[model samples]
Target: MSNQLFIPPNYKPVLNTTRTEKAIKLTKDLFENQLSAELRLRRVTAPLFVLKGTGINDDLNGTERPVSFPIKCMQETRAEIVHSLAKWKRWNLKKLQITEGFGLYTDMNAIRPDEDLDNIHSLYVDQWDWERVITPEERNLKFLKRVVRKIYSVMKRTEYLLYEEYPELVPQLPDNITFIQAQDLQDQYPGLNSKEKEDRAAKEFGAIFVIGIGGALANGEKHDGRAPDYDDWTTPSEGNYKGLNGDIVVWNNVLQRSFELSSMGIRVDAPALLKQLAIANSEDRAKLMWHQMLLNGELPQTIGGGIGQSRLCMFFLRKAHIGEVQSSIWPESVIEVCEKNNIPLF
Candidate 1:
């Protein structure tokens, strides 16, 4: 999410320009180490493009189109660049039959045509996506909290390692994460919209999870929009983390503010998927052929999510510009800012 932070003007790089390359490589390695150790995730190859109507698309907030084109090799197949591997991971888990506790992580690359490019967001999206099979017992609030704690633990561990390896990489992550139910947050500050509450809370308490998502608020408003498939909207808060400012969460939960680093939950079983589809008024999708497999329990029951690699790097590096580390084109305003601040863009 966009958060305002103090930037030092004319602050030239102390380290050589080569650090960007080294930084990205180290970031991948460090993140991989934590993910593999914590989630038992094994690296795998993922699709740059999946067949159209395959239900392999990431419907971020139920909007945004996939970058797609017709493939001649498969004449009938219209392949689209994956928005994220949220659905693909679940399918792979069953296709691969990955056992419980064993999971797969892929370096997912995507083009999000609708993404409003910000300091942290790029048209060229890249991140780590992982999914692991879970037993039926691991689907309650307690189980979810336990998994959240484990994920945070890995992040803490990774932060420590990064600090040690690159002393210049100064990141101050709070040891204790603040977990708040989406409804509780609304209840605490009903007067304020979602972003206001998130900013108020996370600013005071470091990392926070704003639960109670997918549906409308008490006033019949969505805490935030989320797609109906893949995730059981009834069970967990599909809207996850929203980081704090000093952080740019300027406006409330309007189109102005978005803070969901991960959209993970226990994947819906066949029963749950059908129910959610009906609720979302998307039952028609059930007949989409690709969804037929999922409806028949042909997919694995697992938990999966995507993590923003650039955001983590930017936060840790204390660099105001994400372009400093990631090799992506910058908007003119951002580019001007980079040049003005003498912060070299990679």
Candidate 2:
């Protein structure tokens, strides 16, 4: 949450403003098409907000407050701008009768008013939210790893495409992504904090998926917080592990830090939902319509996640600040730092 801006010494943008704008468009288009094809996902329309009290909106980390306002159309009922469409995508799968192995992806734009804006974090969020129906038996670590590899492949391919378009932007991603459990990472770097551990892992592997997020580790601390209802973070995975969810992190040579591009996992089933809800002291959510449908077997079993669009562009294009790729408000302090550092804000 530190607002301190870190600009690498002698940093220079690879593309000018006009070309950066064009590259952003190309990156989004190229990645989206390739991702959809690789995952068998059909692009679908998504909503910016959902009715309050429906348990449909993502309770990211179960802490950050969502931006909500009264809607005059429905007797002024409150509506909350979605943090992410984690649950809604699963609901959509059932509504559309999307068969197994097939899924949907949407351009999800959101406002995270509580986000601590930094070189990477932004108040405005844009990502590719995707979900696919899965069979009951396919909810294991092996299956989750398979999906992660597919997404990583799409990312690598997109990097190559960008290289082809802009020769100055050379591809740096490794051929394959390394996977490690969060507990193992914690054990490896017991003295380091969570972020430090991720930094070490990413730097060492270039790219890695830190599994078992949200759930408590051996030390009774979570690697990071995840909303209980969306990702299955309490299931017993491999030896001593407890979740099927994780994050895709890579070493950002531009920032000299670990950069997270996505968070995804298998959607919680009825048992995992109830267990995680209780663990989170949020069993009351079971009464909401979305929860009711899930508990009653009305929703489909699925795996889904969100890949940050702006983050991808920033990383691939070697920008120092996220503002270089997407337009968003920034505090005067951040603006001053970037201005002094020659890191233009769009």
Candidate 3:
């Protein structure tokens, strides 16, 4: 998909350029500080591109090709733009010798050339990629839920602060979040598709954590595609529940749709890694440097995920188009539509 631009009738930005700039800075600063304190994370430097074929780059859903180039200065070694810092963060946790409760976070920027340029999607991706080392006992469904709750709480606090600062802005998040399993949602709306189910649930709950991604539901179809190596989506919890990972989504009143804010989970261990790699039919990945280290128990047991920076800004600012929040190349058609609707793309 190239572009999927949409502008509501009589749409206008809540904040003008000057106010939007101020709000964006406040959002980033407050959210980063709150998230780091809540998760016990320290900010770290991240790479824009990494050496190719080392299995350090995130494959995403395992199909999207990364932007790559040959480095002449480095003897023609190929370098690939990072899809995400998923795998690299684990390596960092190990190398940095981070404590069990401490982790790292960074401002990750990437170019998703194939991203659908829609109201919420963009080619230029920016996110707060974070990872934290955890004890083996902390690698459970309960722990995952606790972390999700903490992150959600911080998000709500950030929203409150923003609202206090800019009285014109209103809070769109709920005080509490609802949790549901993927299979339960499928059962609730057997006739609807996965996305439709998400929309319905998010709309009703105001905020939700839809658990069990990257694995098949009761209908033998996955709710969404997730990279197997990073999240333990196939593992079963202590009881009947499955998957220690899920997505944080909220209803977008402006777009009148479900909006995803984050995808997080417990990192895959050695056993889970082998199982997931085989399920993905990419067992050859085990031979790669990062994969080898994981299989050998050289990496730390961690939980991490990326929170979309621009998407959050767009949501908070109630902008109809993602281009309004981030400066990125857009199709001429999209430009025309935004201009017609009085949306100023940054």
Candidate 4:
């Protein structure tokens, strides 16, 4: 099924194209400054792709094929565009000798060719991928929740500043974030599917952090699929809590649906890595250079995640389609539908 789109009746953009560009820049700058300062992170440059066999690339959901090509100048060695820098950040943390408190954030650009063309899903992905060095004692659920709250606080701050700058834009985000485990959501709505459950929660809560994702719930199904190598999804979190990783979802008033803005969690350690790799049936990946370093205790204990740049712009700006915030290709059918509905597509 194609991704759904809905434009509220009597809706109009708070800012036109030129003002939209200005708003996007302001949002990026304010959020990055807030997030980096809140997390003690420094900005850095990042690679667009890496060597194929390095195991540094994010294997999102363990199924999506990466966009890869042979480097002619490198004697046919292949390079794969990263889906995310979940692993590379940890290695870089170690390389840079970033102490136990500081971290690094970078603007990561990627091409996900297999992505579905829709209001939310796009072939081009731009995000702020960040990682922070932490002590081994800080890998527990409490620490994860604390970090999540910090990130959410930055988001809320950005929302306020955005509304202040563009008075015509009404603030949609709540002052606080609601936290719930994925299993609890499933239990609450036994008849509904996972996406439905998320939508229901977002509608009810306005802003929510669905915890315990990536692993099997009581129903023998995952709330959502997460990669085994980066996030410690299988690890238990204080009683029934399943994953330390979760997505930040909010109810989009314009689209009238659940919208995901970020995915973050603590990085996997040696034991978690081994167990996850075994469960994924990809133990051969353990021999990869990055995995070997991880298994050998060379990388630092860290927490990291990606915040979608255009997605944030779309949400805070109250746009119906993602193309209104970022430039990317759309199918003829999609273009026709969007045009017919008076949806703006850049």
TM-scores for all candidates: the values are 0.86, 0.99, 0.98, 0.97
Q: Give candidate 2's error at residue 26 in angstroms.
A: 0.6
lDDT agreement with native, every candidate: 0.68, 0.94, 0.90, 0.89
Candidate 1 colliding pairs? 3-247, 3-248, 4-247, 4-248, 5-246, 182-211, 216-221, 217-221
| Model 3: ten consecutive residues of lowest lDDT | 1-10
Worst 10 residues of 4 by lDDT: 1-10
Model 2, 43: alpha-carbon shift in Å? 0.3
lDDT of 4 at 44: 86
Considering lDDT, where higher is better, how would the candidates rank from best to worst? 2, 3, 4, 1
Query: Per-residue lDDT for 1-346 in model 2, tens only?
Result: 3257888898888999999999999999999999999999999999999999999999998888999999888899999999999999999999999999999999999999989778899999999999999999999999999999999999999999999999999999999999999999989999888999999999999999999999999999989999999999999989878899999999999999999999999989999999999999999999999999999999999999999999999999999999999999988887888888879999
Ordered by TM-score, highest first, the candidates read 2, 3, 4, 1
Q: Number of backbone collisions per candidate, in order?
A: 8, 0, 0, 0
Cα lDDT of model 4 by residue, 1-346, tens digit: 2345455676667678899999999999999999999999989889999999999998998889999999999999999999999998988888889999899999999998888677788899999999999898998889988998999999999999998988878777888889889989988999898889989999999999888778888878888888889998888888966687888999988877899999999889999999989988889999999999999999999999999999999999988788889999888777877777767788
Candidate 1 per-residue C-alpha lDDT over 223-266 given as tens digits, one digit per residue, 9 for 90 to 100: 66767776655654334422110111111121223344455666
Write model 3 residue lDDT over 167-274, tens digit each, in one string: 878998988999889888988999898889999999999999999888887678888888878999888964565688899999998888899999999999999989
Q: How accurate is candidate 3 locally (lDDT)?
A: 0.90
Please tell me which predicted candidate would have the highest TM-score against the true structure: 2
For candidate 3, give the lDDT of residue 27.
94
